[model samples]
Target chain A: MNETLNFSEHRMGKAIVLTLQGRFDAAIALPVKNRIRSLAEDGSRRIVVDLGKVSFVDSSGLGALVAALRYVSKDGGDVRLANMTVKIQQVFTLIRLDKVFKVYPDLESAVDSFEEY
Target chain B: MPGRQLEYSARFGPNLDNLILGADLVARFREETKVNIKTGDQIELAVGEALSNAINHAQAVGDDAIGLTMTVEDGMLTITVDDNGIGFLPDEVPQPNFKEHPSHGYGVFIIYEVMDSVSYDSQNGINTLTMKKRLEE
Candidate 1:
């Protein structure tokens, strides 16, 4: 089995876009965690995390979101999620984290929402 | 800490809440592994499910504490949890494959999807379960 959790960074206008693929479970913890942590290191405050490519996620994944949100939001910046798969979305609803994190349909709208806010 | 090894043992009491304890442990692993915070949350949930299964089925004692370990070598990571409960034949326990169960129901199936590798071995009254996945290419 492939051992790496796939992550890519981009920009939706001025917002940072993070795309994730593969299992976001305990087995692939550190790599996934460090990537998100460092993404917000720059001066950028508005961040968008897209889960369209993610196949599965558990509570640990949710905690990761909380951590990223906490990290970026410290300076009035926000971490929003977009393009979540159904299964992943279920995990979010189960724990009511969907409420805590702003979720959108796709990358475009999520970043656009950033402007609306 | 890319090639770090983490090990710890936890007790599983029948009345113990696996979700609570597993979540606590997985949370710490996130910092230990220093991976993506979001992925760490997923790991905690997966671990919680595994611990619950071990507590309820692996050992009759469910009251007995469970042992767990997470190790990172290179970019690969593995998490293992073991229990002293009466073990069952791996073949007998249903595989968590969507094709096998379809839409009837599937927890083990979901577990399999969320992780890259899942294995179990029961020997001498102890059952060891291991899950592995890669953090980066």
Candidate 2:
């Protein structure tokens, strides 16, 4: 029931890592989307979204991810998801969004995927 | 097919907080009914989506609050979300292009995906969306 979306950022080599905790619902999606946009504008094109602590996500949250992907991809970069809970994974699979984004089991692996490219 | 039944309803201002309230309502229902975790999650997400839609489209209609009803009976759970917004034809709302990575239209689709049945009715300035899911023993 907590509406607060705490977004923390870290830098790993060339990638901007964002860790999100709290409900990624309609109330918070736009703000999160704006943060991603700002990151992309700051030349942090390669982004890793860490959702290990995020407890819930709806269509708006998924939309935020898609919007982030579009923004970063325009700069020849991408947004990768990591540490998604099984509940989050279920929602993604139901919407078939699992096919849209590269999801990893942990942040280290997600960061590694970007390093390999 | 009879068991202990429960019904609850609430009316609240159009806002995202009510969406979270809707989720809590589902969780409480799940706890009382002892439904499976997967079914509980599906119900929560579907109800949350419905409430989100209500908040997104609610118009200021002189204190007309969003009305939510949760009813569990006969091995089925039903949730209803009613709003005062100008109702559109549910059929006219296009399905989200999943391949295109569109974001907005997934709300209704998600409700459909999680619920066993969905229906819409708009009359006298109230738009009601009803969704049902069958409980597994």
Candidate 3:
């Protein structure tokens, strides 16, 4: 039941892995959107958001990720999601976002996806 | 527990920080009632969406607070979120175009998807969003 939202970033080859810890709700959506904007500005075209530790995600949280995707797509970049908890995946599926974003089971697979591009 | 009913209620200020408290309240209700994990997840998500909508749309009037009520009775769970902010037409909200990959406007849709029955009513300056789910036998 981690309710605090926090994130850390690191580079993996051509992709940046942003691991989010805690609930991804409206409380932190703006900061996350800004973070993604900064990453895109820094020439990181490929991003993988690891949600292994994310206990929850509301529409605002999902909106931030979609906003990130749109922002990067303008620069011919992409954002992928990885390690979604069962609950998180349920929401994605319910909203049909599972079709829009490439989702992976773990960090290794998510980073590896960038190699195909 | 066929005829027994458990209930919880709380009022939170119109602040994003209160989202955590809203979530904790749901979790507490789920645990106390021994709700199944799958159903609990659905309840949590639906309630979270409802609360987020209320909080985000809240007008910064003095002493504005969102009211949340949850109850489990007769194999059903119901959640009602009330706010004093100006309300909008729920039917007028267009569903997100999945093909276009829209970012916003999924909040109301998700609530409808997870809950068995959803209704919205605004009366006497109070807007209420009520959601319900049937429990497995």
Best-fitting candidate, measured by lDDT?
A: 3
Docking model 3 quality class: medium
Query: How much is the lDDT of residue A52 in candidate 1?
Result: 89
Ranking by TM-score: 3, 2, 1
Give the local distance difference test score of model 2: 0.83
TM-score of 3: 0.95
Q: How does residue B43 of candidate 2 score in lDDT?
A: 82
Which has the greatest DockQ? 3
List model 3 lDDT by residue over B26-75, tens digit each. Answer: 88887788878988888888888888888887562434468899987887
* Between candidates 1 and 3, the DockQ winner: 3
lDDT of 1 by residue, A1-117 (tens): 322347888887878898888656444444555676787676778888888887656555566677667767777888889999777886676555755788898899999987865
Question: TM-score of candidate 1's chain B against its reference?
Answer: 0.76
Evaluated at residue B84, the lDDT of candidate 3 is 89
Kept native contacts, fraction for each prediction: 0.05, 0.71, 0.71
TM-score on alpha carbons, each prediction: 0.50, 0.94, 0.95
Better of 1 and 2 by TM-score: 2
What is the C-alpha DockQ of each candidate? 0.05, 0.68, 0.73
Give the C-alpha miss distance for residue A20 in model 3, angstroms. 0.5
User: Which docking category, incorrect, acceptable, medium or high, applies to candidate 2?
Assistant: medium
Q: Where does model 1 exceed 4 Å of error?
A: A1-4, B1-48, B51-81, B84-137
**Global lDDT of each candidate:** 0.66, 0.83, 0.88
Candidates 1 and 2 compared: the better one by DockQ is: 2
